[model samples]
Target: DLFVLPSYYENFGIAVAEAMSVGTPVVISDQVHIWNEIERSRSGWICSCTVESLTETLKEALHNRAEQLDRGKNAQIHAKENYSWNAIAQQMIKAYGEIQRANSKSANP
Candidate 1:
């Protein structure tokens, strides 16, 4: 399933990640928080949430079967590496450590 989310205000865009987990390429709006990551990973196409942009991107994707398949494969790899439970837990631990250090600094000051 190719997932398309022309969102105006999406926080996590879990559906996008879920689709990617199953090797689906996406076309998502720039407003989605994970858009930058998706773009960097080459897991999907990103565009501003506009009729013209979405249409143009979809058209471009339709003409490139190899590119679409490549994106789908990349999406699955990225999802496994970045959105898996282990990955999320590790990130959470790292974030908590940063928060603790910041709090300690403020307390000491």
Candidate 2:
């Protein structure tokens, strides 16, 4: 129903992505690297790495089933659109192109 990770420090947060992929709304701390994506997608709640913040967010996230379901759906869509293999590949290709362009400009100059 809900996935909560209130870690003091997190890197990539693959677990959060995995949960979003499965349409599970999350409550993650700001320390998670992917928290920005989560916040942008409106797929879950973000809280500070404190018990009070976590508890309050958990309560809010658990309070309404309808809102939870909506957020879950948003999470699923966000994961598919951003974290899917195709999406990742496209991003990589775009980054490579940018690097190539920058290199070309430096060489020509």
Candidate 3:
């Protein structure tokens, strides 16, 4: 399935993430922060929030079945690598360990 998120302004655009998580190719506005990653990974198409841009991008996506499937595969891999719960939890654990180490040092000194 193709997912389109043409928001004028978005903080995180969790919907795009959700779409990518399930291997769906997306067409999102450049305002989404994750657009860069999507573009780099070829997981989706990124365009300005204008109707013309969205229309053209959607047309390109729909016309190319092979590209769409390839991009969908990339989307799933990218989401698993970058946004998986285990990966995020590991990052948080590392950050908290650093915070704890700094606190301990400050307290002891």
Candidate 4:
């Protein structure tokens, strides 16, 4: 199955991530902030926000069974590795640690 969203504006597009988490291939607009990740992971198709683009993307995505399965698996893996709660927590912890290290260096120097 394919999840399609042609939003004109989106902050993070949590729904797209949710679809990816469930191993569903997606067709999302470039307006989504996380489109870069989707593109990098080969998890889905990205298109500009227009009827023509969305329709063309949908046509291409809907007919490719082999690619669909591959993309679905990639989507699941990408979501788990990058968007899961544990992943978010780990990122936050790493960021905080970096901040702490920077502060310590400044204080000592």
Candidate 5:
């Protein structure tokens, strides 16, 4: 299981996505920027940041093992399709190429 807290003072939430990317299910606090994404992707559960809420959410996630497995699969798929380094590199290259071409045209005129 993976836990993510996007609060400004998170002790360690950055590893959540990495774990999820490798097929681990995630439980995220609403304070996290990726909470909505995780929920929408069905990759994990989201809850309020309080201890009570976190405990309840974690309990629910663990009790629903089948559902959690499904979510983990979804998370893995999403991570592969959206967060892969190769895809990100391609996107960055495309953006840079576009900017370079635009700059060249502006410079010519």
Candidate 6:
């Protein structure tokens, strides 16, 4: 399946990752914050948010099913490596630990 999200402004793109986790390739607008990651991972295609760009991107994705399937597999792999909840939780824990240490140091000084 091809998932397309044309957001005007996105701070983060959890939905795209979520779709990719299940082996669904995505087509998103450049406005998404994760566009670079998507492009780099070959998990999806990104285009301008204009109607013409969207249409063209959609056509490309649809016409190239084999390539898209490969991308979808890659997307699932990428999602497993990067976006899993366990991984995210670990990162958040590390950040919180750093913040706590900083706060403790500040309180002592």
Q: Find the candidate with the highest lDDT and give its number.
A: 4
Give the CA lDDT, 0 to 100, for residue 79 in model 6.
91
Tell me the tens digit of each residue's lDDT in model 4 across 24-75: 9889999988898899999999999889999899989988899999999999
Candidates by lDDT, descending order: 4, 2, 1, 6, 3, 5
The lDDT values for all models are 0.93, 0.94, 0.90, 0.94, 0.78, 0.92
Instruction: Give me the runs in candidate 4 sitting further than 4 Å from their true place.
Output: none
lDDT of 6 by residue, 9-83 (tens): 888888998999999988999999999999999999999979999999988889987999999998999898889
Q: Tell me the tens digit of each residue's lDDT in model 3 across 1-109.
A: 7999998888888788788889998899999888899999999999898989999999999999999999999998988888889878988999999999999999999
lDDT of 5: 0.78
lDDT of 1 by residue, 1-109 (tens): 4699999999999999999999999999999999999999999899898999999989887789899999999999999999999999999999999999999999999
The superposed Cα distance between candidate 2 and the true structure at residue 19, in angstroms, equals 0.5
Q: Per-residue lDDT tens digits of candidate 2, residues 21-108?
A: 9999999999999998889988999999888999999999999999999999999999999998988999999999999999999999
Candidate with the greatest TM-score versus the true structure? 4
Count steric clashes of candidate 3. 0
Cα shift from native, residue 99, model 4 (Å): 0.4
Alpha carbon deviation, residue 27, candidate 1 (Å): 0.2
**How does candidate 1 score on lDDT?**
0.93
What TM value does model 2 have? 0.93
List the pairs of residues colliding in candidate 4. Answer: none
- Candidate 1: worst-modelled 10 consecutive residues by lDDT: 57-66
